[model samples]
Target: MELALSLGDTPKPFSLLDHHSGSQQQKMKDLGFCMGLGSTRNLEDLHIKNMMREKDDEKVISCSSSSDPSSSPPPLPLQLDLLPFSPVLKSPPPPPPPSLSHRPFPWLSKNLIVESGSQSKLVKVIDAKPLTTVSDGEELAAGEYSSPNNSNSGTSSFQMDFSSIFNGGRSFNSRKRDLELSVNLELVDATERDHRACSRGGGGMSDEDENGLTRKKLRLTKEQSAFLEDSFKEHNTLNPKQKQALAKQLNLRPRQVEVWFQNRRARTKLKQTEVDCEYLKRCCETLTEENRRLQKELQELRALKTNQPYYMQMPATTLTMCPSCERVATTTTSTTTTSPCQQAPPTGSHGL
Candidate 1:
């Protein structure tokens, strides 16, 4: 007879070969009973086969259960092998930025003109008058002796006497003695008047006035001041030759030019110091503001940490146990719904 089996309520014809051997026919019968054929002996054999299949499946499950999913071995590391002749790509370095020179004093920007010929003429003028070494008493006496002689002098004789006194050819003692011997009453009175005049009119005073106790302050002319300012702008410091040239140009002593340059340098330094101080003050203010802002942000973060909910901060995993097998399992969930492992077991043959 040709046997037909239904799978899921659909009937299909099942057939064995017409020339099948007994052992092969018996094997087909066994397979048919396992697919729900109603035969007592064949059903017993099918039951035994089902039991063996169940045991094998249980063994496979036990092996899988022995190793934990959480304890799975890390994935194999990916090896990167470099190929020969393969070009390596690299980013080129950025070009350097343009450099700027530092200028501390911005106001000193003018160029100075140094005239070589003018400087030479100044040196010649300074060399012409050697500073007098004669004492004040001798100078006074010499002046008195020359007073009467200068009145009559359209002559070579007067020029000779004047030269003899001033040219340093005669000794101071000889000049003083000659003045006292020829000193008339009128001349003595005239000397006293001249002494009074010298005291009253400080201008055009002799070298004795320069050597006196009082310090003389020389005022520079506006043109001289302007020239010095231009020179100072070109170079803060002066060489000896430059100093002498400037002094001659300004009709000032070399000492005066040296003092002016020293003062100018000091003023420039003071101005630079003030600028630096202002810059530092602004930087300090900016840092202080940044610090205050950071402190406020830190306080807000700390407050947020204190006020956050405890449940919101908990980890995503919860311990769970299977209802049918009572096996322990770890579950990761976002919601409060019970997982499949914690659900009630089904009724009837579906319990496994």
Candidate 2:
């Protein structure tokens, strides 16, 4: 027989075993059951105390068995060391609420009629006239205002307040408009300064001596020059955005950046032309030397032909006749005095 005990508000039924033949064992089991009830309340208190202490401790469940079943049960004084089992209690932390900032605006995603509640509308600032007091019907006809928080109806019957539409907060659009206006003012100022400089002959000196005009030269910093060189190496051309970005980075006007790029490209083309001219000069020199060598070889060949021996130029035959026999003979003065045809026959013997 066995008994299970728990230290909670509700007491669960104990698992019963088969009937035991021994009366002493049965009596012992009954006594254990009765003793469990008395210690239940005390166990509950000890469990509460352990829970407070173990709040920050590692999560674990410890269990033990009695060494001697025949021995009597321990006293009702609750001691953790004597306990056989312990149940761990844990409470999970609550989940956080979903954030609206990270959520995508459904109207913008689907290209639907944009509601005022859309966060994208809060960030996007377009130049437009401010809303004026108008009838609800006219406002609905304009189709410029709609609130997601109010009604799903296409037309609103109430006069929509600007403050309420902007959620009672300062509209980012106003600040954005002010920033754009400041940038435009800066651009205008820069243009006016450029015009004044041009009028004062700041670019270059006049050709006529009567008008003594001199240009103002802009010297770029070494760092700025190096950055521009690197950018040029990456790409020789610049779009408007790149020009603007470079101008902002170098603290120069956009026109200045554009002019610098133009001058740099011209310099590159001029250097390439000089290099090509030098290459052509070298090629001309090499061709001249080769032509001179070929002409000298041709002249040597002509001299050899003119200085050839007279005997080498003559024909091999020199006709002669034997005096005693009156026989015709042919001989070459360069080889032998007597012809082979004449020597083969007797000197006095002749066909005549």
Candidate 3:
């Protein structure tokens, strides 16, 4: 709005226009305009605006223009669309990246700027550097870029080299994870079997390990058992120190050695007792057979002696009759035998 002073000689033009409004400055920046101060006349003209008074009317005071019409500034363009010159005047902006915390992986680039000589510059700013990984894979953030005239149309490109800091980590981590999972699976399987056994019979696990392969008892190798057997042959018993030494040599536990010695001693004693019992039984049977043969021979001798008659005796022997018995009696002969009256029945009355 223009205001004119009613001086007695001539009228002067004054204005209450703001030189740089917020919207005007924003539009100027969008158009890639350089912001600078104006001339002294323009500054004086800007400060000449009078503040409104309570009784002043809100109406324009008309005044005539200056002598130079060509010096006046042209009006601002009313219709300015960024469509036709969009490709040349303004370059497409670099896509806005997420914050470090929200990103899937760490990206340590601080700021990415793609600048073109003929077109507008595209800028993408990152707030903070990304965090380091657990393995201490510290990414090296560099801002080494060059704008070549011919290449990329004078655009600046950034390059990064994720060198040996993350080297050998992938294979090591994968193998370690596999081993841990295997151990965990074994433990889990054993636990599950124990739970099942307990649930079925209302009892805890036994020495058989619930028939699980992971719970089977350890068996000594052939070499280990052979060494153990030789040691046992040397001495059937073992002291604590000796057992420890043997166990260390065999790569086994002292308890296992001690148990083996105990079992070996028991088995040896059992075998010896069995041998002695078998020998005694055979000897008893032999003696019984010998006694039976001797008894049979004695019975045959007694029968032969009783059946011999007085006439079958030698000529030197005599026969006589006693007054108490009517039967004939034989005298002592060269052979020793029982008398007919002993171990024999009496003769019939007709024969006497």
Q: Could you say which candidate leads in lDDT?
A: 2
Cα lDDT, all candidates: 0.34, 0.35, 0.34
lDDT of 1 at 300: 92
For model 3, the run of ten residues with the poorest summed lDDT: 99-108
- RMSD to the native, candidate 1? 42.5
> Of the pair 2 and 3, which is ahead by TM-score?
2
Candidate 3: residue pairs that collide: none
Where model 1 places Cα greater than 4 Å from the true spot, the runs are 1-211, 310-352
**Global Cα RMSD, each model:** 42.5, 49.4, 62.9
Model 1 worst lDDT run, 10 consecutive residues: 54-63
The better-scoring model by TM-score among 1 and 3 is 1
Question: Judged by TM-score, which candidate is best?
Answer: 1
Cα deviation of 288 in candidate 2 (Å)? 0.7
**Candidate 3: tens digits of C-alpha lDDT, residues 221-327:** 33345446645544456766566555433434465678777876667555534543453354446446755986999998768767876545645555543212222
TM-score of each: 0.32, 0.29, 0.28
Give the total clashing residue pairs for model 2.
Answer: 0
